[model samples]
Target: MPDFPFDAETHRRRRERFLQETGGGVAIFCALPELVKSRDTEIRYRPDSDLFYLTGFTEPGTVAVLTPHDEEHGFTLFVRPRNPEREVWDGPRAGPEGARERFGATAAYPIAELDERLKGLLEPADAIFYTLGSDAAMDRRVTELLRGFRLTRPRSGKGPADVRDPSIILDRMRTIKEPGELDQIRASAAIAARAHAAAMRMARPGIGEWELEARVESTFRASGPTAGTAFPTIVGSGTNATVLHYVDNARRTEDGDLVLIDAGAALGLYCSDITRTFPVSGRFTPAQREVYEVVLAAEEAAIAAIKPGAPFTDIHEAARRVLVQGMIDFGLVTGTVDEVIEAKAHQRFFMHQTSHFLGLDVHDVGAYATADGSPVPLEPGMVLTVEPGLYIPAADDVPERFRGIGIRIEDDIIVTPDGHEVITRAVPVNPDEVEALVGTEQAHTETQRHGGEG
Candidate 1:
């Protein structure tokens, strides 16, 4: 695994901020548990993004409690203790002692002590903030603690009264990216660009979609031994691209087809999402080029609107305008652009929106409002994806010549004070650039060795 992207000090500050936001609550957060594949086999462990964001610790089954008493000091972390036998079979664990020393936990205890220690931590608190019902086992434990608290008598003037979820406090914090977080996301985006570039280079008329998947995955590995693609790659060719989240990758590429690849790479939980549509034969036919150009224009228009203080909804609408007009100009639909926009006639060929928040989760949580509870104003440190697409399925929709074609262009972007930074700019968006990039060059030299080129 790559070195930890977050610092211990950052994790400490995050917890402190949450505590301050919650006033005086005992907030409980548990690292997600590893699931069993069978009797003993376990699926690969991936720590929850929120847990990792606050703790910088990736071990599963670890839990933490930020309490009032520790507000003056620090939070306490409860972790699984290390076992020599288990370590030999699996790997080293950051046990209780390591958690305290390395993770800056004020107090560290074995996870086995949670039931006993939790009551003590919650006794004098005002509220208990937790993620409700996320883990049934953890939920039961919290219920038991709350039940016991309810049964216990209140001191004359001192006893806990409420249980609330602290996620409301944390989600707002996560929406804005920090300088370090941007660096991690940029790294992830760079890796994602390489993967997309690899797939484009290896594409050919006879290649199976799985071959493109291999190219994408291999590019991620080659870029750096980081977390794999942030999500399963959509390596759809021709009509499959219209399916949106296409992942089967079973179809074979053919002449005069477009391959829509929606993929990204994850590094230290930070993600970079990108999409590009290219011709299987390395050159877009006239009909494909016409539609691809419109989507590209929409992508650029959306990207241009992503400035600090701008409403993201504006960008979405901006992209939609270009696509709606294109459908009219191409005679794909018969109506005024304004009428089509109102009727959402573009939904036939362009169904999805233009962008979404991007970060720790592909769609990271952040406030999209101001202090008065309106839509969150965009600000520096926010990252998002600008993807604009046009999908024309082989349907009896007015024209047979403009059927079964799909094209989309996406890039990871960070809002800047004056403008927005295209983080995934390394992946070209111009149709001419895309053709030139995928047409023939070093890509062919590399993929030809792998027998990916026809």
Candidate 2:
């Protein structure tokens, strides 16, 4: 699909880097299995992120074997054999021949031959790098293979003595954005930004939350044939917004209600995640504006602290300080900002963290802290989301006007050498700008009523 974005050389380079980290070991990667949705129907299949990162192969029943020091045959692929009858039901397969010719594999074999081939590959390797416990079937198969290898160790004098998880190297590599990955992430962010803008304009009283969900997904699909949402869209209106992970979009918007939309798009395997809240009536109430401004201030402060060399915790601290102070100023809580933060009293309204790693997966792989339990420094190639939210439920402790209000502003930012870049700036976040865009719905409706006479 879409020519796989990168060539086989790029994948080979990544594999080489991984090999360097893994040292003299044989690494094995298996693609995820297809799942049955019902009695016979199957859901759309997506390749495992780890396997795809190394081979650029998106087919199921495929396994890749890497031998770092092998001069003639370092990379080997085992894929499902091509069958004419199965080809009619499913799509065409790369087959063993195509795998060697197109994927640059040193050698290729049918899936049925994997067990037999593993004997030769693992005989000389002292260590094995694999994702243990990920697949029970594969785990059993590998265990049996190792046991078989041990039985022959007296005759061959070699077998793996250690096993390691490949994620130790792969996760760290994925944290830093490469040039090709940045292009895909930027494209996905741009499409998601446009979808958010369209949803903002279409939001109005009496509109069902599912309608906005439909509009967002349709906009993403319209952007490109390969584009689709990275996650299930979150379109919560009114009180439903208070629920953190609300997906039941069954409520209808009401006057003076705030709709919080958390959505993103997946383009070329890279993902973008963004969240924006706006007034359903195109005008924020006084109480809504008060809370919205606080969350906005927190987001801005967090984004400002995202420069390279800054501690990752610094960003969250900057946002938390502003939110805690704002809560005190609004009379929602009664304590100094320091006391409130120390006691975590502000968590009553704001609970989640201010940021997260964003990439191929929405909550992408990356270590936030070092082995010593200290915050890691932000690097130039790291990309993250800065999101600050305040959700106030209906309780006696909360003020009447501020109850049932939820507002969160999120954006994707890339750490630059000197500063940070906001990749999703295509969508407006200022309160006035949000109102201006949302007001266009009424203007369009007016024009349609008069049959374009205006």
Across 231-331, the per-residue lDDT of candidate 1 in tens digits comes to 88898898998888999999998887899999999887788899999988889988889888898888888888888878868888899999989999888
Best-performing candidate as measured by lDDT: 2
lDDT tens readout by residue for model 2, 267-374: 867899999999999999999999999999999999999998899999899999999998998888888999998888999899989999988888999999999999
In model 1, which residue pairs have backbone atoms overlapping below 3 Å? 175-366, 368-375, 368-376, 369-375, 369-376
Candidate 2 — which pairs collide? none
- For candidate 2, which ten residues in a row score worst on lDDT? 1-10
Clashes of each: 5, 0
- How much lDDT does candidate 2 score? 0.89
Number of the top TM-score candidate: 2
